[model samples]
Target: MKRIALGVQYDGAPWNGYQKQLDRHTVQDQLEIALARFARVDVATTCAGRTDTGVHALEQVVHFDTELTRDTQSWVRGVNTFLPDSIAVRWASEVAQAPAHDPHLEFHARFSARARTYHYVLYNHPVRSPLLAGKAGWTFRPLDVERMRAGAAHLIGQHDFTAFRSSQCQAKSPVKDMQSIRIERSGDAIVFTLRANAFLHHMVRNLVGSLIYVGNGRQRPEWIGELLRARDRHEAAPTFMPDGLYLAKIDYDPKWGLPQEAGSLLPWFSL
Candidate 1:
């Protein structure tokens, strides 16, 4: 059997989430169905991250093993033929699995990924745009971008993120290495960029929600530091809606044996 890695993108509006559900639409269910149809066998897939319902992905990584010997091009076209319009297999390639370096890692892949990046978009305007309704979180009140950035700055680096984690989170530990978090304004919208080794459930949204309070003058920017120190969920703001979030990209080490042209396969929005 050959192990293959797929780069997938999907419109999360119609699905329950990334994982397969017995009674609902899911990205994994659709992809597995498509893969079974094309390969004529059961295909089990493992993703780098499981995005919640209404959360989109620009370059979600997944791996599966297949006995079929088709080339990368055929895997792309064959799977796309069976997939729904909202989901697409952007790229496919044979992958060489690396030796496991950390048995405690929660993710399934054997490769050592460098980082995972996520982006959140908030529409801060008087009126909502019909076109971006489900694509961007709508915040009618004006936000102080500078204050939000200041709050975000406190979240960077290694920290215990229990305050930002979801109640349903299954992560074994609350400690995470957050590389960076930045909040910036683009036109009438607020965009947040977050990069981390891994994230707890609703971590990004919770952080964003807390920063929103700071931006609106309801909370001081330094309060974020206090919240981090507290490490309690109740001390943080509510988890924001998932509609504005996107799994932007995952970076892997060069030694993972990925294709030389893999960089070219990145989603346009990630660039």
Candidate 2:
């Protein structure tokens, strides 16, 4: 059997999440069902990240070992036959497994990943746009981007992000290396792009919620650093909605040869 890696993109609005559940509409369930139908065998897939319900992904890397052999292009088009309009297999490549005795092979859809990127989109308007209701989060109060930037600056680099982590998070460590965070405006939409070694559950949304507080002058920018030092979840803002969150991209080593660009896979994002 050969291990096959797949690049997946999906709209999370229609499904519960990436993980499969009994009697639930989920991305993994749909994808596996389609793969089983096409390959005529069971297909258990492992992903780089598990997004929350209503949280979309631009380039989610997943892997599954199968005895069936098919070319890259065929894998993309064939499995899509059983998938819904919300999900599609973008690209496929065969991952080379390490020799049993070599003990150096470290490639995995989740473990092998070096970093993950997320984008949170917010529409700063008094009246919410019906067109972007489920596509983006809406904020009625005017947001000061500079204030948000100041708050975000304190979050960069290595730190214990316990204040921003979700109560349901199961990550072993609260310490994470936040590589970069850039908040910019595209038209009326305020976009936040963050890259981290790994994120705790609801980390991005929680951080965004607190930043929104700073942006609207409800909280001072210094409150971010204070919260970080506190390492208490209660000190941070409430977790924002998942509607605006997107798993924009994932970073893997060159040996894996994964796709680099996020492209226009999702409806709202251009990154």
Candidate 3:
């Protein structure tokens, strides 16, 4: 059996999340159903990341083993035929696999990932836009981008992110390498881009909410550093809505040759 990697994009509004559930009302359930229909066999898939409900993904890498021999494009177009309008397989490629006796070296969709990138788009206008209701998060208060930047700066580098982690997070550890955090505002829309080696549950949302507090002058920028040092979840801001969060990209080594699209927040908060 050969391992095939697929690049998938989906709007998470219609599904519970990326992982499959017994209720069969998730992105993974839908994708697996489509895959079985296309390949005429049950196909199990593993994803690079598991996004929360209502969190979109620009590119989610998945790998599955199959004995069927088909070209990459066929997998994309064929599986898409059975998928809903919210999800589509953008690209597919055959990847190397290690022997079954030593599977640790295989090109795993989740294990082989080097980094993850997430974007949060927020509308800072008094009145909410119906056009972007579920597409973005809305806040009535005016946000200071510079203040938010200063607050975000404190989160850079490897640190124990317990203050930002969710109680339900299943991650083995709270220590993570926060590579970068970029905050930009285009008109009334503010975009926050964050990259890390990995993230705990609700980590991005929690961080964004705290930064919003700093932006609105509710909390001082220095408060973020205190929160980090304290490592107390209760001292941090409440978790922000998942509507604005997007799994923008998953970084992997070049050997996999997966066709990944560039990350962007266009037509809304382009910067």
Candidate 4:
């Protein structure tokens, strides 16, 4: 068997998310179907994380085991040929050994990644943007970027992120290490950048929603710190729309023994 890694990018608006569903189109379903067509066998994939519906990805990672003896270049072309226009396999390579026990076996990847980065787009303008409606979260209220940045600072560390996670989250624990969270405004758009070891469901969206409240003066900047201490979901803001979010990147340590350029072929956020 040959174990191969794939770097993918997709417009999430057309599908149900990364995981396959019985009757819905999905990133994973498309990839697996394409792989089965190319290799002529049913194949399963393991992804770095599961994105919600309408949430895009610039660099999503996955691995699969196949019996095919094709070159890396063929894997990329062949997969793309079978996939819809919304999905693309940016790169592929054979791995010496598969990352360890599959997540499906026990809900954990074999290796630990260094970090994952997510970006959220908020359109702050009086008029709605027809071109960006499904790609960004739109709000007409003016936001105080300085206040949002101040509120974001309180989220930079390991803590119980229960307040920022959705009740539907299936993680074993609410504790997560948030390396950094920053809020920046460019013109009429607001961007939320977050880097973490891992995330629970709707964590970034909920965090952004809470910060938006601070930016609008609806809540104090220090309230984020208090919410963290409280560790209760009701103390946080509502979950923002998934359309504004994107999985920007995933990082793995060099000691993992993968190629140095393993991540280079993946796409990045354009804005």
Candidate 5:
């Protein structure tokens, strides 16, 4: 059997979430169905991370084991022909599929991931833009980017992120290495870029909400440090909307040779 890794991009508004469900109304369900039609057989898939409903992905990495042989381009064009316009296979790569006992060499999509980067786009204007509807988080209050940046700095290391975790999260631990958090603003658009080893459910949204409070002067920058030490979910701000969140990238070892792209958090804006 051969393991095929696929780079996927999706709008995420039409589907319930990334994972399959009994109702079969999800990104995974749609992708698997398209794979079945293209290959003329059932194809189960595993993703690097399962995004929540309405959360988009610029490039989501997924993998599946198949005995059927096909060229990489065939997997991209062939599967995409059966997929919806909102979802498309951007690229494909075949990786080493080693035995279960020797997992170090095997390239499991989720397990092999080295880090993840998420981008949260916010529209800070009194009047919302029709063009950004369903694409960005909106706040009528003015936000100070510098304050947000100061608040974000408090979360830039390995720590227990229980304050930012959702109650529904099933992560094994709340401790994660928060590599960096960069906040920038261009015109009315504010973007928060976070890179980490991994994230807890709703962690990014919650962090953004808390940072928004800081940006709006509702909370002091030092409050972020207090929240971290408190480790209580109720102490933090509410979870921000998933509409603005994008799983921008799932980083892996360079040896894998996945054809991924690099760009600003928002394609148009530069930090």
Candidate 6:
């Protein structure tokens, strides 16, 4: 048996979320259906991160074990032929088997991942953007990028992120290593990028909401620290929209040699 890894990208506006559901249109269901069709058998997949509804992905990594051997290019082309226009298989590669479940595999898509990075695109115009609706989050309030960056400082490094997670979060631990959080502006858009070991449900959106509050001077920069210590979700800002969130990148050990930057989050302003 050969283990295969695939790089996936999708616009989440038309689907429920990444996970498969009985009656819902979802990324997982779409991909698995495509895979099962191409491989002529049932195929199960595992991903680095599971995004929520309307949360797009530029670089999502997934792995599955397959008995049939097809070349990488064929895998990409064949899978895409069955996927909806909103989703695409960007790249594919044979990987070390991660069969810990059977005590014989080498890589687990969700387990072998090291870090994930996200980019949130916010349109900070006094007027809403018609072209960007459902593609980017818009706020009429003018945001101060400097203040947003200042607020993001408290969220860097390891800390309990309970206050930033959704009520639906299922992660056992609230403590996560937040590698970086940065805010920058290009034209009328404010972009926030965060890298972390892992994330809880709605964590990125919740954090961005709080930072947006600080950006608009509604809260002090130091308020982020207080929210962390509070460890209460209600103390944080309301969860932001799903449109602006993108799973930009996923990190793995160099040994895997997975393709890098297969699906780019850039051309960001165009969206």
Please list the residue runs of candidate 2 whose C-alpha ends up more than 4 Å from where it truly belongs after superposition.
263-271
Q: What is the per-residue lDDT of model 2 for residues 1-271, given as tens digits with 9 covering 90 to 100?
A: 7888999989899889888999748999999999999998888999999998999888888999888879888899999998999999989989887678873584689988899999888999889999887678888999999999999999999999999999899999999999999898766789899999999999999999999999999999999999999999998889998888889888888987765565423445453
Candidate 5: stretches off by over 4 Å = 99-101, 263-265, 268-271
Number of residue pairs clashing in candidate 4, backbone atoms closer than 3 angstroms, sequence gap of 3 or more or interchain: 0
Clash-forming residue pairs, model 4: none
Report lDDT (Cα) of residue 219, candidate 2: 96
Q: Write the per-residue lDDT of candidate 6 for residues 1-271, one digit (tens) a residue.
A: 9989999999999999999999749999999999999999999999998999999999889999988978999999999999999999999989886455774348777988889999998998999988998889999988888988888999889999999988888999989999998787888988888999999999999999999999899999999999999999999899999998999999888898888683335695643
Task: Work out how many backbone clashes candidate 1 has.
Answer: 0
Model 6's TM-score against the true structure: 0.95
Model 4 Cα displacement at 260 (Å)?
8.6
Please report, as a residue range, the 10-residue window in candidate 3 with the lowest summed lDDT: 261-270
Residues 151-220 of candidate 5: C-alpha lDDT, one tens digit per residue: 9999999999999999999999999999999887889989899999999999999999999999999999
Candidate 2 matches the true fold with a TM-score of 0.96
Clashing pairs in 6: 97-105, 97-106, 98-105, 98-106, 98-107, 99-105
Candidate 4 error regions (>4 Å): 98-110, 255-271
| TM-score for each predicted model, relative to the true structure | 0.91, 0.96, 0.97, 0.90, 0.97, 0.95
Candidate 3: C-alpha RMSD after superposition: 1.2
Worst 10 residues of 1 by lDDT: 260-269
Comparing 2 and 4 by lDDT, which wins? 2
Q: Model 3 reaches what TM-score against the true structure?
A: 0.97
